[model samples]
Target: MTRMLLSVERDAIATAARRVMARCDELARMSSSTEGIERVYLSPEHARVNRLAAEWMREAGMSTRQDAAGNQIGRLEGAFGPEAPALMMGSHLDTVPDAGRFDGIVGVLMALEVVRMLRVPTADGSFRSPFPFALEVIAFSDEEGTRFGKALLGSSAVAGTWDAEWWNLTDEEGNTLREAFREFGLDPGRVGEAARRPEELVGYLEAHIEQGPQLDERGESLAVVSSIASARRFQLIVEGEARHAGGTPYDRRRDALLGASEAALAVERICSAEHHMVGTVGQLEAYPGAVNIVPGEAHLSLDLRGEFDGTRDAVWQLLTTEIDAIMGRRGLRWKAREIHAAPAVFCAPLLQDVVRAGILSTLPEGVDDPATIFSRAGHDGMAIGAITDVGMLFLRNPDGISHHPDESVSSGDVARGIQALAEAVLQLNADR
Candidate 1:
């Protein structure tokens, strides 16, 4: 059999990237929030974006459909017949409030580009012969968990890991998730049907902006992900007595805010002492937050991450232990609850090698060493990894900034990512 060169038109890929970026800007503008780009799960704006993406998929000549979970999937049939598994690629579409243009959108757009480039003429002089296996481009909904407090909601549903009880969950405004689903024209009960049988998936791939400075610092355009760090989030609440800020005697006051601040500092100190360990108190709230009043309660959320599960768990335990000691010493009542935890994920070795080879084959000369690093952030690939083999490619982010409006990746990096991704897909398809 003759080896077909799998290549994408540079101009066409650039055009697709621009289109994706435009859509991202539009989505960010809708439901704008002070925190970031607030496209909440199952909101009207989210549906609109999904519909537009579906239309683009169809226009690109792929068979597109929306799953019960509101995930948009575009399918390109394979010449090797229906018996072969598919090459599935995508990432989430949702973003935090006031987010940048590239974060999640790039992955979805690149998937579309892969499908467009792979389209060949059929034997009957109609559509071209498909690749060896089906190609699926998915735009996963609700990955940020900004609305429902659950990340990877769409991907988890498709992976058959989503809890049915989540349907009963309501936002702060009392809008149930089921109601949100109804508003989006999807049935909540049928979400389980979105799961793909193991036989249907040959492998999964995702290409995303680095969202960190690893690639930029290395002066490389792409990085093959080796692992995703383990993460644990905790809500720590400290209780004290509220009193007039000026009237409360320093000796008599049980200041919850002070205690919480001390705890946060301890977390930072402990994490810094441990190599490859990180801890952050990203969100905190104080009751009766007034200039003249002493805070009675302090509630803070701690996010801990590490490259190894044991290290992460140990750091978490240490943080909690120190918090207990601080509470005892400060004579403050406190409670801690675990909000979320994700284990470290290592990409499949074979798939990582394939991606590396593809990158080396496509990039400019002397761009030989692309960084191999573990992600400290979670992604849709993590959930999918639970069900099947998965891999990821990270494009350079010039400043290591993400989840903010200033997050960015260069055009040169994006072009390199497209080439690498295209080659990886082709190599994987040719394997079977």
Candidate 2:
């Protein structure tokens, strides 16, 4: 059978996919959990994985280093030498608790593979990388925020947005982020050094799984992301008087838990009514809890996300109105504290065109168009957007799962990812 890719290119793509798969499995095994995969930022597992990734980067003909924020970085020079401006490619290395294998790690591995393919001969037997820009693979140390309750720490540092106050953020074990950095051999004071200048990068491209099922539902292997949703997170507290459950009748008692439950429902209703908006109450707790006690207070966490800031704020406005009404009706007091906010980011048009060409190259001529997904999930790109234009390609996740052990990606998609990435590099240089 005839192949669209040259024999060597096919071999490289296949080899790269297998290598990525192997590396993901290896890193998964290095997790902190005994039962499932759990590797937090700046932990022992984080250090070990950085070493492993650095080793792989070196093997693939790149100069590797760990940035001041503890992110693993590898730079591969192109036709020009080391100082040449580079196209930054990568995703985070951090994972949520009991995480799956492929969420962030796959992107980092795919980045390395792209560089490997660049170093080899093309169909025309070219010795040099087709692109004018060099390539850099970054395994960002913290995007999940499972430990510090703050995402994009590593990428933020690289973007020169490092929050000095984050050093005091603590974990479940009461270990401050500053202490964790010290334990991981990273100097907290030097984190500013991780920041990269705007002129140093050509742009950024990230390969990540479509955390939602759009690609799977559309029967496509990949999707080019158009935008990542803006997000706002809040801590909600509902206060009421505690009383003996047996003595407190439903009509007579002030139940904070019930009030909080209504607030959560209001969030869902308000957010769902808005186009492409999502609101989730991911955490909830009641104080002085007992089987028979009327809860005195309820605390819940809310995460609201939308395609645009105006639309998201509209939902928030409606939600707050509903919250006030709910509190007033329940004779309870409620408060909301904003904790995190990330604005929506649209991919650059030029980079999107390039990625579209890359996707087309992997498919048969005149085949169906690849899907375009609006990403509701967050990524390092949001942080990197501060420094340069950004684009992303999404691999299909059949189960539409994430942040759990069941998250997965197909080997075929991995191979296609390699091919598509190589084509993107060629297209960018060709356009220049």
Clashes (backbone N, CA, C under 3 Å), per candidate, total 11, 0
| Model 1 local distance difference test score | 0.82
Tell me each candidate's TM-score: 0.93, 0.96
Clashing residue pairs found in predicted model 2: none
lDDT on C-alpha atoms for all candidate structures: 0.82, 0.88
TM-score winner among the candidates? Answer: 2
Error of 1 at 398 (Å): 1.6
lDDT of 1 by residue, 174-293 (tens): 888999888888987788888887778888899999878878887788889998889998899999989999998898889899999999999999999998888999988888899888
Off by over 4 Å in 1: 1-36, 124-129, 365-367
Give the winner by lDDT: 2
